[model samples]
Target chain A: MTARIYITPKPDILDPQGKAVASALHDLGYQEVSEVRIGRFVTMELKGSGSPENRQRIEEMCRRLLANINVETFKIEISET
Target chain B: MTARIYITPKPDILDPQGKAVASALHDLGYQEVSEVRIGRFVTMELKGSGSPENRQRIEEMCRRLLANINVETFKIEISET
Candidate 1:
């Protein structure tokens, strides 16, 4: 199984990296872009099959180390293929 | 409309950051994790409605700036909601 996690900044938080990217986009003529928020995309290979318990474990990992619960939000997707 | 872009390193690439993260997770008791690869997740708001043309434009952006064509691959999802 593999788990993919996305950690993004809270909507109210300021993202300097996103701001810089947006500004760069504007300079490059992508004027249709109004805003951009950057986040982390993490993919990990797990030892076992996907299960409710595994999901819970990944969620715990996100809360403890993958995300700054105070200013960031996370979503996890686990799949077996 | 809002678009989400996920840029991931090519499978053959070495991801030192991911290694560090996996090592940390292992130290924190997540021994089930065997491998990890980290990337960038970007969310952007656009001025126009979601359209095929808009998707193509976003893809071009990914090729030119958001992703390094040499070592990364990107997936884009555009939606009206």
Candidate 2:
């Protein structure tokens, strides 16, 4: 199974890196790029079948390690193909 | 309409940020977090309705503004519901 995780800053959190990127975009003549927030996409190949237990374990991992409970949020997508 | 775009460094590209994150994860006692690369997941609520032309435009925008053609690659998923 493969798990793709996306971790991002919470809406109310301040994102300095994202702001810097946005400013760079503006300087690059991308005026339409109004809102920009930098996030993370982590892709992993898990060594297990797609069982309910495995899903639960992956969720637990997300809560514990893959995401920071404060300031950042995460979403996970799993694929069995 | 909404679009979720994932931008990431290519496999051969060097990712200093990802290395730093991996080290942090290791220090956090996540031994299983061996491979960690930081990427971007951009969620955008587009104004117009869903159309092929709209998708093309959005893709063009991604190529031009949302992603760097040299070291980063991007994939966009659109949701209308």
Candidate 3:
């Protein structure tokens, strides 16, 4: 099975990197683009039968290792393909 | 409309941050994890209808602003909500 995890800055937190990217976009003439928040995209391949138990394990993986729960949040998408 | 852009290091690139995270995970007792690669996740709430043209524009945004085409690659997923 494969899983994709998205790790992003907390909504209330300030993101300097995102701010920098937003400014760069403004300078580059992409005026329609208003805001940008930068975060993490993690893809992992796991060897396991795709089951509810495995899904639970993957979520645990995100909470413990893939994301810093203090400053960032994470969402997981899993696929057997 | 909303769009999610996932930006990740090129497969061939060396990711020190990912290495650090992997080591940290090992320390935390997640021995099942063999490798880690850190990347970026961007979620943008976009205005206007979600159309093919709009999607193209969003992808251009990724290529020009959200990602560094040299070292990073991006995939955009758009949804009307």
lDDT of 3 by residue, B1-81 (tens): 878888889999998998887787778766655677788888777677788888888888888767789999888887888
Cα miss at B42, model 2 (Å)?
A: 0.3
Residue-by-residue lDDT tens digits, candidate 2, A53-78: 77776677778777787988987787
Question: TM-score (0 to 1) for chain A, all models?
Answer: 0.94, 0.90, 0.92
TM-score of 1: 0.96
Which is the leading candidate under TM-score?
1
Could you arrange the candidates by lDDT from highest to lowest?
1, 3, 2
Model 1: per-residue Cα lDDT over B6-79, one tens digit each = 99989999989999999999999999999999999999999998888888889988998899989889999888
| Of 1 and 2, the candidate ranking higher by TM-score | 1
C-alpha DockQ of every model: 0.91, 0.41, 0.56
Which ten contiguous residues of candidate 1 chain B have the minimum total lDDT?
B48-57
Question: What local lDDT does model 1 show for residue A17?
Answer: 95
* For every candidate, C-alpha RMSD to the true structure in Å: 1.0, 3.6, 2.3
Docking class of 2: acceptable
All candidates' lDDT scores?
0.93, 0.74, 0.80
Q: Write model 1 residue lDDT over A13-70, tens digit each, in one string.
A: 9999999999999999999999999999999999988889989999999999888999
The residue pairs found clashing in candidate 2 are: none
Q: lDDT score of model 1?
A: 0.93
